[model samples]
Target chain A: MRNIKLTIEYDGKRYLGWQRLGDSEKTIQGKIESVIEQMTNEKIEIIGSGRTDAGAHAKGQAANFKTNSEMARNEMLAFFNRYLPGDIVVKKVEEMPERFHARYNVKGKQYSYYVWNDPIPTAFERYHSFYFPQTLDMDKMTAACEKLIGKHDFAGFSALKKTKKSTTRTIDDISIEREGSMLHFTFVGDGFLHKMVRILMGTILEIGAGKLELIVIDEIFETKVRENAGETVPAHGLFLDEVYY
Target chain B: MRNIKLTIEYDGKRYLGWQRLGDSEKTIQGKIESVIEQMTNEKIEIIGSGRTDAGAHAKGQAANFKTNSEMARNEMLAFFNRYLPGDIVVKKVEEMPERFHARYNVKGKQYSYYVWNDPIPTAFERYHSFYFPQTLDMDKMTAACEKLIGKHDFAGFSALKKTKKSTTRTIDDISIEREGSMLHFTFVGDGFLHKMVRILMGTILEIGAGKLELIVIDEIFETKVRENAGETVPAHGLFLDEVYY
Candidate 1:
């Protein structure tokens, strides 16, 4: 069976997350799978590189599926885009080796959280950014971010209710930068636990607001206690930027 | 009476137009007026610098109203923003002289039209830009734009059903530029008749697509007949960039 790789972009505001759930078909995977079944007249299971939470957007999500249809790559892309909703788009389609798996073959993933720090509220960017009217200390936030880089047990930063096999994850890079009225936090890691990015962003925001110190982050990581971590920021500000293999 | 000036921004996608319409309270002015009446408990009238058509967005639309609420400028700005819809924003509020009228004191206006000249359909910017898959002749479009600059009786380019007192208008500047996959056309003018910018954009797009010659634009303007003009483009891609006095 030929493996078809698809690059996806979606505005995840109205979704119930990427994974399929119950009889409710209001999911990104469910929508795509239903469209594929309709076109190919066959039931196929598509695997995604990662699952982004509800209200979290994506720009370059990767997925793979096996299909026997002899449709051209361009035609498949066009068909997927035509059938999908306006918020979701299949950017590219390519045929890969039979052993190619979207999840197993992933080398790393990058996520970004956006913060609108301007005093005045932004109407157009309300959905894409977390609005914080309070003044932030950028130096303190950057110091906290630097401590997050490299391999570490991210159990304290992730949600306590996660059922992952392990909480230890290797973070390749973490950087915080400000652009005009927006602050962007980018994290590249081998894998992320449930709500890990949002929780980390919340911790950084607390540090920036002078509520939590940089040493507090290290103490939480060392203690491996989820309760010691900062609150989980809302999902609307977080985005799955890219999945790399 | 002190004239309260408001610098406004709106998405305009859901509005009928800037002016109030019969039975339909979907106009931008109507929405603002309703909110103002609720805040001040008075029947307030707001005069806009120009009437933008339905689906035409604005970045710096100017308006003025007479209110004796004794509210500070910042309070007024904050109160309106809190009550207005997410798509509309009052950027700034200022106390002006009694003689300052939004409609009568306008010296010039700037409008911009965006065209997405990409083969792939865009999801996020679909509502804000016109999609033109075919390649355009930028040189030809630039030449045609140059001809549109300067004073002229734009009766041929204006909408046929308009009931304006004068069709003569002076365009101070016209610029057509391409950035990446988007083409932007900006017009600075003393005044514009109904659908003048849209009709001009349509004509330029036709010329860029090799359907018409550059000299044909001059011919249409010289004819002073509405039949000589091209079709009016959709209002979604057009924006009232700013109004100047």
Candidate 2:
């Protein structure tokens, strides 16, 4: 068997999520697996680097699967794209060593969230950005982001319903930038917990709006209580940008 | 009474067309009129620069309406955008002279057609671009575009169902540019016939594919027969860019 690595891009607007769940075929993984099974005439189990919730897009999501067919990289890319729907695309496909696993061998992942801070709405960019019309304090938001750039127990930033045993994760880098009427927050980390990015964004936004003090972030980080965290932002603005291994 | 000149933008994928038809309530103009009627408690008729077919988009469409309401430009812009659906936006509102008209006072217009020439489909840009996997000869396409640059009767390149009394239109400029895997064809003209840009793109694509010779363009122009023209391309790839007066 040959190990194949696939780079995927999806609009995630109508999907339930990335993982396959039961008989419902509304998930991204289910859609990809169904197309692959139809092409290979066999049941293929694919592993993704991580799960992105509904309405969270991805530009360079990585996945791996074992296949007996010795198709070329370009051929596989073309084949998958031909069968996939308009909202999902296989950007690239590569043959890897049999030991290369997409989930376990990942070095880092990057995510970005977009906010449209303009008073007027944009017709084309409505789906890809969150509309926040209120004025925000950029300096406070930046200060809060700087404090989040190190290793910490991100328990407070995750959803209360998450069942992950360990809540500690290291955030390698975090930066915020503004361009005209759009603000972008980029985060690089080894791994992320459930709804971690959204919760962090929500916390920063609260600080920016003067609803919470910037120093409150440290208290929440130390407490590790879900109630101390801010609200979770919407999922449409979050994008799983890339995976590096 | 104040005459308002509104700059509009829409993702026309959901609308039947720009014009209101038989109380369908699904047209772009119908949506705008309903919102205006609700805001002012009076029925107002809005005139657009031209009609865009279903699935066609607009970036800077121009329209004008006469209203007695003493609303400022900024307030009108904000109010219209708030009432309109997320897919449509009134970018700007200006109080123009009563003599100003969107359609009759227009001097020229610009339209652009985007073609994705990559082998793989693009997930994010699916609605805005046409995917063409075949290799195109850019030199042939450019040469054919040059033939259409000067003022000429574009009757042969328009749709056969067009019922305009005059079939003669002057094309001020036509250009075809290729940036990586994206091909953009822009046309500036005094007026355009129905589906003129799509047909022009189809004819140029035929020349690029070597299916039709460059000299056939002149023959079709002289014949002025719609049957001699190339096939009408799809509507989703066309964008009404701007209207100038």
Candidate 3:
């Protein structure tokens, strides 16, 4: 048995998300598994590092699967590229250690959300970025970013009311950059809860727009209540940029 | 009556090019015209700098329309943005001279074609770029670009068989740039014939792939036949980058 690791890039616009749900083949994982099943002629389960929400794109998503096929890495890569849809590409494939697990062995992740701040919508980025026509205060948003950094209880930011897993996660860094009318938010963290990034973006954008006070960040962190946070931004603007092992 | 010039930007993925076709609301010009007609309650024909082929995007496409409505520029800009589809945007709107015509009072144009040279597909730029999974010889392609410069009868490059209009047009400049796995070909010229940019891309790409020699450019020029040139590339990779007046 050989364990194969795959680096994937996908445009998540048409996908139901990364995870395979039931028999529905509208998912990113289902698409890849179907292609692999056709190539290997075997039923095999593929494990993803984590689930990206529906309509959320990924640049370097990691996955691994155990297969008994004798195909070489280059051959499998070629096969996947040839068979997989153009929107979902297997960027790299390699033989991994027998015990390697994509989900359990994930060390960290990086996510970036794009915001188009101009009054006029960006034609090309309409699907990929959040279009906020209102003016934003960059200075206030930058100041708020400092507060979001470091380890904190992100329960208020998640979509779920409660999770069996601990909600306390370390946000290594959060950087907000502005280039012309485009604002980019980059978040590096050990792990993220469901819709945590989107919620945080919503809250941060509200603060930038002066709708919410900057002190709301502290209130949300201490209370650990979902209602205390701002609205959950759309999944289209979020991208699972990188997954580190 | 006030003449309004609009600096337009569009994704073109969902558009049937920039021209307003008969009863087709899918075109970029048709969408904008509909919005204007709704706002002003009058049927106004919006003239574009030129027609981009179907599936061809634009960053700075210029258009002009005559309207009797005394709407301010800012108000008109907001109204168009609100009513237009998300994939199409009016970046800027300004009052123009009554005689200023988008198609007639022309100067030059800058068009760009994006090529994803790597085997792996781009996650974000899927619809905006062409995935050409072949090793390109930049040196050979550059040498060919030099030959393609200056005033030439580009009848061989166009898809149209016969036209009364002169086929001679001066190419101001052609520059090929590579950034990572993406190759951008920017062309500045007086005007392009039907599918001229795409045909040139196909021919140049063939030269880069070593399938066609650099001397084929000269032979195609002398023959003045479309059959002598390479295939016409896909329209999705082409962009009307800028329209200069």
Q: Pick the TM-score winner.
A: 3
Would you list the rank order by lDDT, best first? 3, 2, 1
> Candidate 2: which stretches are off by over 4 Å?
A70-75, A160-165, A176-180, A226-229, B160-165, B175-180
Q: Give the alpha carbon lDDT tens digit for every residue of A191-228 in model 3.
A: 99889999999998999999999998999898887887
Better of 2 and 3 by DockQ: 3
Cα lDDT of model 2 by residue, A165-218, tens digit: 888889998888899888999999998988999999989998998888887789
Candidate 2 residue pairs in backbone clash = none
Q: Which candidate tops lDDT? A: 3
List candidate 3 segments past 4 Å from native.
Answer: none
Q: What tens-digit string does per-residue lDDT give for candidate 3 at B135-206?
A: 999999888888888999999999877889999999999999999999999999999999999999999999
What is the C-alpha local distance difference test score of candidate 1? 0.86
Writing each residue's lDDT as its tens digit, candidate 1 over B73-185 gives: 88888888899987888989999998999999999999999998876666666667888778899888888888999988888898756555778899999898788788889
Error of 3 at B80 (Å): 1.3
> Candidate 2 residues B1-245, lDDT tens each?
88989889999889897988986478889999998898777799999999999999998999999998886788778888989999999988888999999999999999999999888788887898888878899899989988988777788888756565887778888888888788999999999988889999888888888878998899988988777666788888989999999
**Candidate 3: fnat, from 0 to 1?**
0.91
Fnat by candidate, in order: 0.23, 0.84, 0.91
Sorted by TM-score (best first), the order is 3, 1, 2
Return the lDDT, model 2, position A201.
Answer: 92
